[model samples]
Target chain A: MYEGVVQDLIDELGRLPGIGPKSAQRIAFHLLAADSTDVRRLAAVLVEVKDKVRFCRTCGNVAEGEQCRICSDTRRDLSKICVVEEPKDVVAIEKTREFRGRYHVLGGAISPIEGIGPDDLRVRELMTRLADGEVTELILATDPNLEGEATATYLARLVKPMGLRVTRLASGLPVGGDLEYADEVTLGRAFEGRRLLDV
Target chain B: MSLYRDEGVVLRTQKLGEADRIITLLTRANGRVRAVAKGVRRTKSKFGARLEPFTHADLQIYAGRSLDVVQQVETIASHGDAIAGDYGRYTAGTAMLETAERLTAEEKEPAVQQFLLLVGGLRTLAEGSHPPGLVLDSFLLRSLAVGGYAASFDDCARCGRVGPHPFFSVPAGGVVCASCRSAGAVTPAPETLGLLAALLTGDWAVADASDARHRREASGLTSAYLQWHLERGLRSLRLVERT
Candidate 1:
């Protein structure tokens, strides 16, 4: 252990997800050698983010006020709602420029190994958004892994009686990839979801 | 670096560093092994989906200081897609994976029986031939037996008495005789015991012909017995759809 406040900093940094003890120690040393002004700016930004950023009321995406930028936008298509697992997912989908609808961040997926279930996510909020009959399509963009698929299945069953067009993102080979390199599961899904050629 | 080859099932994975993942596998020869797969989370990863839960794969691993590094992977059976397509089967498969990891308490220890049981269980689950609940129960019973915590459906678990006993106790190992019956013992139906026996011995005809009520009762007893021996209940077991 290091002396006094330096040790305290390392402990706090170590508590963050994916930041282990070794990385925490390295980051602490790097901060110590940096300029005081840069450190102060980082500290100020951290405090300001905590004070200002809050989850959107409609969706669970991170926001500065009542709603996120996407939720507040008037030009976005109101008939579609794409559900995702995290705020980072919203950024990823946004970069594609293919989807112009709003999003619902579920906060996380249903991972039984981690003791997480549907109740732990923002399912109830998404249902409320759909209750108004504004959304004609509900797109599930959750990850293709086990926990994510379970969450999507749960949501699909829950909303089946509501008469909405529920759809999940297709699983297949990645773009700009060779077919021989794809895994069996991916290859199988690609064949299952194959499209017919239109002359 | 010394390298070795093995065939195994991917039990689970956790993120490491920026793009790598620490994959835990239950192998036919090496038992439970944890290895790092570099850049596996990236989109262009060659075998990312093949390392998912319930997937059977042939792997080449390089021995590391603390954790081994995965060098090559070939899919032997991609049961994940078939199992994950349905909610009931997915939850059952997850519980099986969790139990496999839980039963093998040591790393690098050979557990060939446990590995074979898991592979067969996953295959049965993916095939959707029987109810997922039944498949999970059978897997749990067999896995417990391999782990040296086998439950007795006939004869006395506590005493040397014979004949079918009435009282069943989880802590006492299984069905107890009248002379050995103690507090907290439950008197399950005769059919529940028969169903459990059929499950353990792979008597699929008897198991498939059993009634739904008996299946539910057998599942409760099986999970209780499994948790009792494990000393802690499996978190994923509760999420499995028993019906």
Candidate 2:
């Protein structure tokens, strides 16, 4: 271990989600050697973010006010809602520039191993939003992972009686991927979900 | 700087830094090993997608002082997408992976039986042949057996009694005679006991044909038995939507 303050800094950095011990140590040292003004700016930003950012009351996406920019936008389509697991996923979908509908951030997927279930997410809020019957199409854009799938399935069953058109994102081979390297399950899905040419 | 190659299943993964991950793998030869996959979080990384959980991969690892480093990885079977697409199967598969990690409980020790069982369990789960719950129970029972905690269902676990015992006790190993039954022993239905036995012995026909009540009872007993042996409940098991 290093001296008192250095060790403390390293430990704190290590506690972050993706920062391990070695990386923590490297970052701590980099900070110590960095200009004081830069470190101060980073510290200020961290505190500022914590003080300002909050979840949108309507959709659970990160926000500075009661609602996120997407929820407040008048131009976006309110008839369709794209549900995702996290705010980062909203950014990812936004990068595509293809979706013009509103978004509902679930905050996280249903992961029993982590003691996270539908109750722990923003499902109730989503149900509240759907109660109005304004949304005609509900697209489940949760990650194509086990937890995400579980969450999607649970939501699908819960909302089945509501008469909304519920759908999940189609998953298959990634672009530029080799067919020979594709797993049997994914390859099979691609074949089963094959679509006809529109030309 | 010794380098070696082995086929392994990605049991779990945790982010390490800006663009790296710490992967826990259960390998055919090296048992359960923790290794650092540098820059695996980067979009341009060659083997990033191949090292996800539930994936069976061929890996070349360079042994490091604190942790081994994964140098190269090639996908053998990517079960992640398949397992993730279904809820029941996903939860079952997660429990299986957690069980494998818990059973091995050591690094670099050869556990060929555990490895094979995990591979088989995942393959069966992905195939969606039988109920995911039944498959999970079977995998858990077999894994416990491989870990030297095999529960006795046909005969008494404590005393050497012959015929099928009526009492099932987690603390006493498995089925127990009336005289050898523990304080908290439960008298499950005869069918439930039969279902448990079928699961432990890979009798899928008997297991598949069993009624829902018996299956639920068997599942409860199997989970209790597993927790008793592991000294803790598996987190993934609680989330499984039993069919």
Candidate 3:
């Protein structure tokens, strides 16, 4: 371990999700060598973000106040709600510009191995959002992994009685990728979900 | 760096970096192997989907200093989609994968039996021929047997006395004779014990014909036996839909 505060900094950075010990040490040293003004700015922003940001009341997406930008925007279609595993997924879908509807961030998928289930996520909040019967369609854009699929299944079953048109995102070949190179599962899914060409 | 080829089932994966994952597989020849699959999270990755859990694949790996590197992956059977498509199968398959990983324990130590069991279990699960719970119980019991914790259903686990034991004990291994019965031994239905034996011996006709109540009882005993031997219960086991 290094001296007092420097070692503390490294330890704290190492606590982050993806930052390892080596990267933590490297980042700590880089911060020590960096300009004091830059360090202070970063520290201030960190504090400010924690103080200012909160989860949206309706959809559970990260927000500055009561609701996230999407939830608060009246222009977004209220008849549809896209369910995603995380807040970052909201940004990804927003980037696509194809989905004009609102979103419901589930925070995380149902991972039994990780001791996570439907109760651990914002599933209740999503159900409550659909309780008013305004939502005609619910798009499950959860990742195509085991946990994500489980989450989708759980949600679909829960909302089955409500009679909403629940749909899951398609899993298949990536755009601009070769068909032969595609994995059999993906190719099979593509075939299963095949669409006819427009005239 | 030496390159070796092996057929294996992907047991699980963990994120290593920005675009890489550490995949753990039970290979036919090399036992349990953990390898880094770099950039597999990228959209354009050559074989990202091929390395998912429940996929049996032929892999070309480059031995690295710490963890091996996956060079190329060819899909032998993609059971992931089939298993993941249903909730019951997904949870059951997850438990099977976890059990296989736990049984193998040591890396690159040629656990061919466990590997084959996993592949077969996955294939059967994907095909949806048998109930997911039955497949998982069979897989777990067989895996325990391969790991040297084979539970004796017919004879006493301790005294080796023959025929129709009354008490079932997890720590004592399986059904115990009246004289050999210890404290906390459960007296399960005779039918439950029969179902377990059928599951262990690959008597699918009997297993398929077993009653639901007996199946649940047998599953409970199987889980207890597995957990007692494994020391810790599998996380995904509780999530499996028995009904």
Candidate 4:
């Protein structure tokens, strides 16, 4: 059996996805042998993330103060809200550099088995934001899964009644995949939501 | 010893250190199961292809303290290929996988109803007979029912008073009367409740007759009901295309 603190590290690491007992032990040892300064910095950031960053009051995205950077940016289009499930998704969308609109992060998607309901998320906050009538088009950017679709549909129903246009992300099979490799369900969605190529 | 056989659908698979694979399955008799399928990464392995996601199979696994070892596998239905061929079903199936994993976390918990329902749902999806969205909604409603969170459409979800209830409360459970309705729950159209009941009971004749608006409304109800019970949101549900 492993020692107390080392075994504790292994136990904690094992709880993470894709990490098994062996990997957890390996990682624990590696971390134990790592430089003190490097380990201290990693530990410091973990604490800072919770202490410094907080959910935005207006849109629910992660923020340093009252509002997130995207929400406070005057250049961003406030009238169009791109709704998403997690704050991490805000980073993903910003990476594309395509959208310059405000965001509404739902914090989590609707998952019933875990007992996660619409009330558990910041959905009521979204309705409160829409009440101001500044948002016109609400882009649903949740994951391409059942829970995500459920959240998007729930959001659409809530927003459409308020007269905002709700649109979901178009479906397409991932790139670099062979036609033969593509599942018919995914291929069918690509056909149904087909786009006109500029080229 | 005799083969300890059980029915399951492969939830996911990942390559292990080298030639092995870690397969996650939601079994009928056993809840969620993880087993090592040795040398499955190699092309010559006999049952390697049997562990693909969405494929329903009967497995005989060697019980181990550290990790169960897959002894043999027999394909019950090769749904993965057919389901993967369509976009809507694929995305919907992914959500089903997450739901299945959440519903049955403990090993050998006798999730027979859930396993059977998923099998039927995947079979229906692969055949491309009913609308993919409707099929998924039915699966979601039934899955919740199997988990003991069945939503009432006709009777009051709170008082058991029978009548045409107008309000759908995810937190309050299901359909609610004017007396039982919370201050802020969204009231879906009457036709939406009918579609939901039909979907829950597998009365496709009623569900198939639903118009686009009714179907959409019913879907919203089902998804919300599901999320209310499943604490962590499904990672795949965001991809569902609304009609």
Summarize candidate 3's per-residue lDDT along B1-243 as a digit string, tens digits. 399999989988888879899999999999999999998888678788889888899999999999999999999998876777788888888899989988888899999889888889999999999999999999999999999999999999998999689799999999999999999999999989999999999999999999999999999999989999989888888878777
DockQ values per model: 0.70, 0.42, 0.64, 0.03
Q: List the global CA lDDT of all models.
A: 0.92, 0.88, 0.90, 0.80
Model 4 lDDT tens row, B169-219: 888888888899997678888888889999999998998899999988888
Tell me, per candidate, how large a share of the native contacts it keeps.
0.70, 0.46, 0.60, 0.00
The deviation in Å at residue A152 for candidate 1 is: 1.9
TM-score of each: 0.96, 0.87, 0.95, 0.57
Those runs of model 4 whose alpha carbons end farther than 4 Å from true positions after fitting are A1-199, B1-3
Q: Total backbone clashes of model 1? A: 0
* Model 1: residues with Cα > 4 Å off, grouped in runs: A17-26, A197-199
* Weakest ten-residue segment in model 2 chain A by summed lDDT: A180-189
Clashes of 3: 0
Point out the worst 10-residue segment of candidate 4 chain A by lDDT.
A177-186
Candidate 2: tens digits of C-alpha lDDT, residues A117-174 = 6778899999999999899999999876456666788789889899999999886777
